[model samples]
Target chain A: MLIKYSVKTALTGLITNKSRSILTILGIVIAIAAIVLIVSIGQGAKDLILQQIQGLGSKTIVVIPGREPEGPSDFVNVFLDSLKEKDYKLLKNKNNVPGAEDIMPLVISSVKLSYFDETYQATILGGGDDEINNLMARIFDIFPDRGSFFTPQDVSSRASVIVIGDNVREELFGESINPLGEKIKINGRNFRVIGILPSKGQVSFFNFDDMVLAPYTTAQQYILGRKYFDRIIVVAKSEKVIARTVSDIEITLRSSHGITDPDKDDFFVETQADLVERVGFITNILTLFLVTIAAISLLVGGIGIMNIMLVSVTERTKEIGLRKAVGATNKDILRQFLLESVLLTAIGGIVGIALGVALSFVVSLILTYSLGLNWEFTFPLSAAALGLGVSAAVGLVFGIYPARQAAKKTPIDALRYE
Target chain B: MHLIEVKDLEKTYYIDSVQTPALRGVSFKIKEGEFVAIVGPSGSGKSTLLHVLGFLDRHTAGEYHFDGKTINDYSEEEIARVRNKEMGFIFQTFNLLPRTTVLENVKLPLLYSGVKESLWEKKARQVIDSVGLSHRLHHESSQLSGGEIQRVAIARALVNNPRIIFADEPTGNLDSKSGKVIMELIQKLNNDGHTVILITHETYTAKHAERLIRLSDGAIKEDAPVDHRLVAADHFTK
Candidate 1:
């Protein structure tokens, strides 16, 4: 039979039983929709993370006081105090690390802040000296919406001064009240809020809206009572010199800690490029896992198609016999049925792709408006194509047996079939 | 050479490995353009003989030749081609595809024929018109009366312009008046120089044909020409 007529016949057959056809393809539709939704959302998340990492500046490198964590269990190493004052001082020297532009020793801890009866738990970020403090501000793109950052005099004299995030300011003082120069009690010591930060939801891994910033000297001596630092942030003079600056910082830290072997180094360095790659790998793996799970539905969907096709063949036995008597060959019968199944699944795939895209877009909108994240709606074209291709393949694989069963019917027996 | 010739044809049905014979050594020869009826009571194997003659089923032990070629002489594809080009079938149930228009039902055979797509509708319309169903060309089969449905089935069988047409109790399911009309239509097809093979249990209906082959108990009891054939046109108009 001509392919055109075969398609017409198949379409007529499917259309004659519209409800059954629709119900038959439901599995395929849901499966493809899930795959598309997962891949699109995964791509969106990866893009958001990469964009945030890029916001940290390509020339900036972070040296954490731990060996590179390989898994969740190794995360405890992050709290080690390997990056101390001496190591920070060594990295700051121009002769020791020539490519370094600015280096800041970082101390991070959760602290409770209270102003009168209002109390808020806020993350504390401490940086050394005025220049280091300025570099921290530039790296995080954070500046006070009101008042100013504490000066170098405050750092040297270990003044009890603090910079508060938007949320922290809202919590300690009501929105109507001016919070600058108001003293907030922290760990039994009174610290004056010298700056109020603008609300920035999340940058990299930190939510700047819920943090408190102060000089490392006062935080370490009065608040934390620790002599060691949690991390050291380094800025390369140019993007091209980031690699050299990272090596220089590593060499200076390793020598300052009296480490001889490179494998025995107590700290690990991370550049923005490394963080982007790691994020991509993690997201890709997550997307692949979800896609695999979605494929099980496709398998079930294919079986559903096969089951429906078989039932259709049996129910239309007389029709098949009539077609045979009218001179349709076995191959023609097979082609007609196979085309019916493939067309069914391909339609499901298209509808699924549309549904998945619409759903993900709605979800991204929710994340952006309600949750206040910079979430983007992404249409994963590759996933759409793959979904379409896989659905068709599912049709072909599952449709063959039923089509063969249809083709194997002898005209006399089929015509006599009740 | 005869258009269809069979000798010592045998067909056995194996149900759960038990042998049950449907046709026992049936033999017959039909010439071109002859109107022959294989008439028998129920379970007389006349239907089985018609099935083997029409190439709708294979005879297990037989020499059955159609157009001077044995069934094995043609490949599976060639057999389908021969069936498409040379034979047409009318079932007892009319078998017009439900929910399909009269024109589309007649056009079904042409879809499987070697005819061009551009000429399918034209050929189908001509045959449907010949059956006097031109007024109901767009009507669905389910909407047609029993007599009209049979006419549509006849149109479908004639659409491919086959050399031989087989009617398996063409008027079996109709009232007497409609039956007379259908019998008249089949007789008219025979008069138009198409070879006709009719299967029927009613001797009164079998008399419409010029020759009759009586079958009983899986064998042919008699093969003879009719002395007083019933002319269907004399009894029915339109």
Candidate 2:
């Protein structure tokens, strides 16, 4: 009952000093807003990366033809030709690896594409006809914007046909000219353009807008003269069979390479789940760093609350005396002042959370619509709840000193205070 | 039994190892329902004695009793309880909380007294009505006139039905006209069977009580019943 009265009195005190209360609470508002915005943005970023990775089909596993590159020093393994065509054939056969639904072999290298006087350096990706049918058309939203992709007959006969990205097409042929049915030279050999790919700005560090696609057999034998595949993408038959497909590829590759020792394997396999975990780990660290910086401001805000509360107690000495003279115990005075500070911080916290959420929405909009980032709007309920709890804790921790000072006053001296 | 008893009450102040006495071995008694005035010059310790009597301060060496029970033996919490239930104070400044409604000011004491929650607002309203402030119940104390503020203080003092009301120069800050009204209100409380301990320096204000105790230099110089009560009309010309 007394607590209820104390809260009422505390509110009265705050109302009496309207501007001071607002200014005091401003500190907490900024601090809490920073916390909420940072945490929400962090959560949004993590979700965006995870969603992008999942967008490429969660049932697909990527097999890179090298040891797992742990650092920049180990990136040299990406250029090593360890996996052979026999390994791809073995992984593709359903009898040998029943868990595999389909496989697309890829070989990519930087090459210059020329159309008479106009020339542009672009990544030329070599893939089978099944790649455009399965990986490109399904995983990425890569349907031909004009003409059509090379056919299975072209892949089997090593046809000199190429499909160019929108950027490459725009560079070789002007906006008015049609690149379809035209011939482009790759490494001094002429290859007819069979398709023009739709533009995809950037995905997972690879700029699909700046690449060209050609048949793997034609690129290996006629262009680069390389016989090894760069990477293999295997789609599992079903979501439930993804783990089985990973183990099946590992077992088949292990026997195909004549490798018995697990550590000495010349290839690395990664599923969508692994990439999601890695992304989550990275975003968690970023969130923690931002929150730590935000917490410092909250601490400063708590200190401001403490300072104001102390000043309030000092200024209201006679008022304290009047209360004590009217039968208020030390505890009552203490609780009154304490309640005032806690209420201040709590109100500040609630306003901050609201402002943070609004700010997060603005930020997400800017990221998605303005910057074209794959950002999602997310309100982390746990962070909002934590903000409230931390605010109350700040009030409790910083408010106690001034409250104790208020409570310790002797009624005689306090009453005498001018 | 006497409502308040004092024996050789002494209050000494120490500042930087200097001992200055505010109350020097004084003694007094006040019976229930008595309208007693303690009149003294500045530094006479009348306020200190009242503070000690009201349990606002601890006496440094004294035997004190209220209702025949030893007051000095009670803990601070117990004294606070007694003050909440049985004692009320009116300051010279009419120390009502600023920016608060008159009714909230009167309800302040009961808020600390552990009174029934349902009785607080009703009881405060009743006391406010008694002081002819029913219309001003919602007025902020800071906005009230000196006379109205004093009346509100009186209402606050009387809200809990305290056994005794201590008015320390209740009209010290008011004009003679407002001061007279405050004095009559306090006098009316006494006439209505409430014990009143009036502390004042002004002769005219002290004259409202039936008995007067004069003090000088931290000691009681005189204590006796008044032979003739001084009237406010006759004394106001000076």
Candidate 1, residues A1-418: lDDT per residue as tens digits?
Answer: 8888888888898999999999999999999999999999999999999988888888889998877887636665643878788887788889999998878878999999999999999999988575544656776789888898877777778889999999998887987889988999998889999898998888877888999998888899999999998878888999999888888888888778888898777899999888898889989999999999999999999999999999999999999999989899999999989999998999989999999898999999999999888998888899999999999899889999999999999999999999
Best by DockQ: 1
In model 1, where do residues sit more than 4 Å from their true spots? A76-79, A93-101, A128-133, A152-159, A188-190, A237-245, A291-294, B230-238
As a TM-score, model 2 comes out at: 0.92
Complex DockQ per candidate:
0.73, 0.67
Q: Candidate 1: which docking quality band?
A: medium
Interface RMSD of 1: 0.8
Error of 1 at B38 (Å): 2.0
TM-score of chain A of each: 0.92, 0.92
Pairs that clash in candidate 2: none
Candidate 2: which docking quality band? medium
Top TM-score model: 2
